[model samples]
Target: MGFTQADYEKFRILRVTHVAKRFDELIADESNDALLPEQLFLTAADDALAERAANRIERAVKAAGFPIPGASIAEVDYRDGRNLNPVAIGRIAATDWAMTVRNLLLISPTGGGKTYLACAIGMAACHNGHQVAYMRMDQLARRLTIARGDVIAHQKLLSDLAGVDLLIVDDFLTVAIDSEAASDLFSILADREHRAATIIASQTGPAQWAIDLPDKVAGDSIVNRIANNGRAIQIGGVDMRQVRSHEVADAL
Candidate 1:
């Protein structure tokens, strides 16, 4: 009953009205609980702070532009047939690699869930308070093509891509990249090297990358940057999509 209006306003501004209300209720009726008013207020404040942190993480994840925004490591399948290593994933997650900007290279056959795994990693990075962005290689190339005419816009776009803590490039090597696109891609990777991390989900392996990229020089540059410091994960098994389709058929 003795709470100041100014204190209530401050709590509301911090988005901790629940804490404020709880304190008010405690002040009104301390007979219900034996704990001191200060102790109750501190506990409520801790809960409010945790809620705010979670809200911030959710907002960051939403802003990350993940193709599968809901992807999470908890949903990853480590069944017998899949070649994924749970230990490796654990090790990766335990490290500060995301903070150090180490790259992740996921190589798999078509429909092997490479994109999903990459997005899962991106989501984890988001949980760790890192910013992320997801884009398909062809789509990114197209965007670069459109931005080419305007030097300022092109640089700004490249800057934006490079600025994120993690950039997930999915469906890589889906098609042969032309010289211009290859150059732009290399520039983006170059700018990001040692400054930020990248996750590349490719159906094709690095060994075949040189053959797919038309500009051999630029292709080599980009591949070298990734290979030099990135950790590679070779995912092998039947396509999950096909398995899911069969399951649906059976259900039907």
Candidate 2:
């Protein structure tokens, strides 16, 4: 009875309001036995609150522009020939690294499911109650280029990227990063380093990153930021797309 609407609202426990409302209805029922005090607290701790929180997290994740819809860790296929280490992946998924300033690098050839795997991890991080964002390097570079002349807009974009718990950059270093792009990219990484996590999916390996970067010093700096403390997973095998196409052909 001491639980007030103001208390719940102040604490941002919106789901508990529904419980309190239901309790009020039950207490008012003529045939109902009055709810016990412990039962009232138990109602607030129920699965409903967890579900509501999960839904909100999902919505936030979707709003972050993840390209792969419905991607999930459970949906990954570990087919033969793909040299994926399940133990390593399991450790990565089971930990809070995505929320604790760690980094993941997915290196694989084209059509090797690098993007899909990165998205799945991003989705998993979202499920773990972390904010996430996803973008292709080319797309992000274009955005950065467009915002270059506008100081406020550029800072705002960097600020937004830095704030995410897990920022996934698909197809990173796919093309030569020129001076302008390198500067912008460095700013983002510099802002995020030691403060949050990043997942970079690339067909190019780190050893070759320096060659592709137009600015060698900047490129090395960026690579050092990622490679120094990041976990690298090399995915090598037949293209999953080709395999899927063959399966579809057989079905047809």
Candidate 3:
């Protein structure tokens, strides 16, 4: 029978309490969720358990001072029967990447899922409880230049970047690096060396990145550090961006 308004409040509270207790009990046994006979009998806020899982991952990554995923993010595809170095992921997760001082370079000819792969790795790093930050190099450079007018603010921004556990430089060398920015980049890399991991995604390979900086010495320095005992993941083949666009066009 439907309860009166006052009775409803009492029943609702009791029901909530019961659900809370159940959640506490079942949370420890995640696999037992399927044994729950009726969905309605379960607490309305049952998602608390799942949310906790996500939160645990988020918290762990944050404590590392890294960038985790936002509201919407997904892994890149490598097609059926294919994986994007799951074994490496296992090693990376178990290993303390924050201390590895290694870097990842994704070399693809644009739209070949370079950015997506970098993002996926970042997400995995977060899940494995590492801190991660992600940004396209061009965008970061652009923003840095724009924010230069505010010295107090700009320094803070650079400092903040230095604190993350993993820094993802997406589309690295997308644009030429100037003298000032090259110095800044070098300092950032130096500070992060042996203290964090870096994921660099770029259409151009390291050898082809001569356009990154005007000063050969400064440019070479940055390149040397990146390739210094670092891991490189070459994402070759046709541009996925063009392939997808062509398919869409053909469909139309």
Candidate 2, residue 30: how far the Cα is off, in Å: 13
Using lDDT as the measure, the top candidate is 1
> By the TM-score metric, which is better: model 1 or model 2?
1
lDDT of 1 by residue, 1-252 (tens): 566889889877987787887667766775747888788789777877787779989988888778888887888878776788888876665546446878889988888888888888888877887877888998898899899999999999899988887888998879766898888889889999998888899987777887788887888888988778888988887688998799899999
Among all windows of 10 consecutive residues in model 2, the one with the lowest summed lDDT is: 10-19
Compute each candidate's TM-score over C-alphas.
Answer: 0.87, 0.83, 0.67
**Model 2: per-residue Cα lDDT over 25-123, one tens digit each:** 555666555668577556645645776887887796776688886777777778777877677776676658544777888998899999888888877
Off by over 4 Å in 3: 1-50, 56-75, 79-86, 89-95, 242-252
Worst 10 residues of 1 by lDDT: 90-99
The lDDT of model 2 is: 0.80
Candidate 3 structure, TM-score to reference: 0.67
Instruction: Give the clash total for candidate 1.
Output: 0
In each prediction, how many residue pairs overlap at the backbone (N, C-alpha, C within less than 3 A)? 0, 0, 3
Q: What is the lDDT of residue 21 in candidate 1?
A: 74
Q: How accurate locally, in lDDT, is each candidate?
A: 0.82, 0.80, 0.67
Q: Report clash pairs, candidate 3.
A: 66-131, 66-132, 67-132
lDDT of 3 at 55: 84
